[model samples]
Target: MMTPDEMMTLVTENALEYGPKLIAAIAIWIIGSWVIKLLVSGLNKVMDKGKVDPSLKPFLCSISGIVLKVMLGITVLGMLSIEMTSFVALLAAAGLAVGMALSGTLQNFAGGVMILLFKPFKVGDFIDAQGYMGTIKEIQIFNTILKTADNKTIIIPNGGLSTGSMVNFSTESTRRVDWTIGVAYGDDLDKARAVIKQLCDADERIFKDPAVVIVVSALADSSVNFAVRAWVKAPDYWGVFFDMNENVYKTFSKEGLNIPFPQMDVHLHK
Candidate 1:
């Protein structure tokens, strides 16, 4: 056993030997963190200048900086005589547990990154996916948000979206409008076709290149069905659909065309 004076002297010598190292370790960590932030910001600017995908830049920079900072932390801890192997073991175990617990969430996050990079749809595009049709409002880390035509907000997981079929209605600049009308068999087919063609010609929103197709589609027991297919700018699709529907009925009525009502005839014979 050492005397009191000897123990005190030993303590002072240990402090003198280790205190600077401890201060250096802490200073390195704090300064290294600030430096990492600066580097990441500069890297983001470089990526932007290179015209990298905007959505991917942030994730790449953040992940790269975090990995570098963690390595720096380990290096500093080792310099301070800390047990680096034990810290690494703890990190590995925690990572394994987190991976197991958050497998689905990680999959969604990965899918979200893919969606952002590939840009299948953008904000304001009307898309159908996972049995929902709506305009894309936001793209988040794990999910995408949409606003439906009926004014409902919908949130869809990115994992489901990635694995399903996506129909983007707003991808094309032009959209086709097709409407079917049924007229009584007694009404003149020529007259019905002429009315539809005239209606198409009168609409300013309708495109004339493809030309309107007003043709007899079917002959049923009760009535004759005709189909009017027209092309219009995508922005005018809904307006044209509504206008053509109303115009067809009004024009047919004005021209004395007979629109048959649904009816059934039942007879009993003895």
Candidate 2:
């Protein structure tokens, strides 16, 4: 209903009022985006310098970038005079719903964070947890991947892994190998002990500082058990264990030591 000239004047007035705000909003968006990129890059450098695990670095960088961009988006929305209170409330409600629906997933995420921070175990380390034993192949946000000795792949949820007890075999540089050797009760106990000691001493992989222990641990009905304990490098544990076992068997056989087996004699009376 307004005249043409009046319409033109109104449009002019509105443009003059809004033009600077629009330009300022655009400038803020551009500057904010650049700043966010810089911050993300700087964060990556800092994490690298701090020696963050290789598996965690990419995940952390991605999360930081997303958070910064989201904050930037909210700021830009505010600059454009969009109603933020309702939007924020909607976001909170949506987040609450998602969180409730994915409670277990959130726990896994938290567990992942704890793992990255505390470093209970790393990739390639053998660990036993949650009734499974394997070498750690990959550590993800939700689960950890393991490769078993038989080449089976297992995926364990991080939540359970974080809470459960874990034995990391590779944590220490050295580990003790324990073994029990049994000989017939009729065998010469002193001669058997001497041969066992000789076998352990000749093995180059066994550590000598702690000294190998060969002791008569138990005397059973069928045989006498000798407990053999030795220390070896963590990596050398399996090799030394198998080697010593074979060597002891061969040496005992050549030395005429009798290895025992369980035997039961049954007599029937008619």
Per-candidate Cα lDDT values, in order, are: 0.90, 0.91
Q: State each model's C-alpha RMSD to the native.
A: 4.5, 3.1
Candidate 2 C-alpha lDDT tens digits along 179-268: 999999889999999998888888888889899999999998889999999999999999988988898888888999998889999999
Q: How many residue pairs clash in all the candidates, one count each?
A: 0, 0
Model 1 segments more than 4 A misplaced: 1-43, 49-56, 71-90
Q: What digit string (tens of lDDT, one per residue) describes model 1 on residues 1-270? A: 999999999999999999999999889999998989999999998978876667679888989998998899899989888888987999999999998999999989988887877788888999999999999999887999999999999999998898789999999999999888899988899988888889899998998889998889999878899988999999999999998889888888999998887899999999
Which one is best on lDDT? 2
Off by over 4 Å in 2: 4-23, 105-118, 264-270
- TM-score to true structure, per model: 0.76, 0.82
lDDT of 1: 0.90
**Where's the lowest-lDDT run of ten residues in candidate 1?**
47-56
What lDDT is reached at residue 236 by model 2? 95
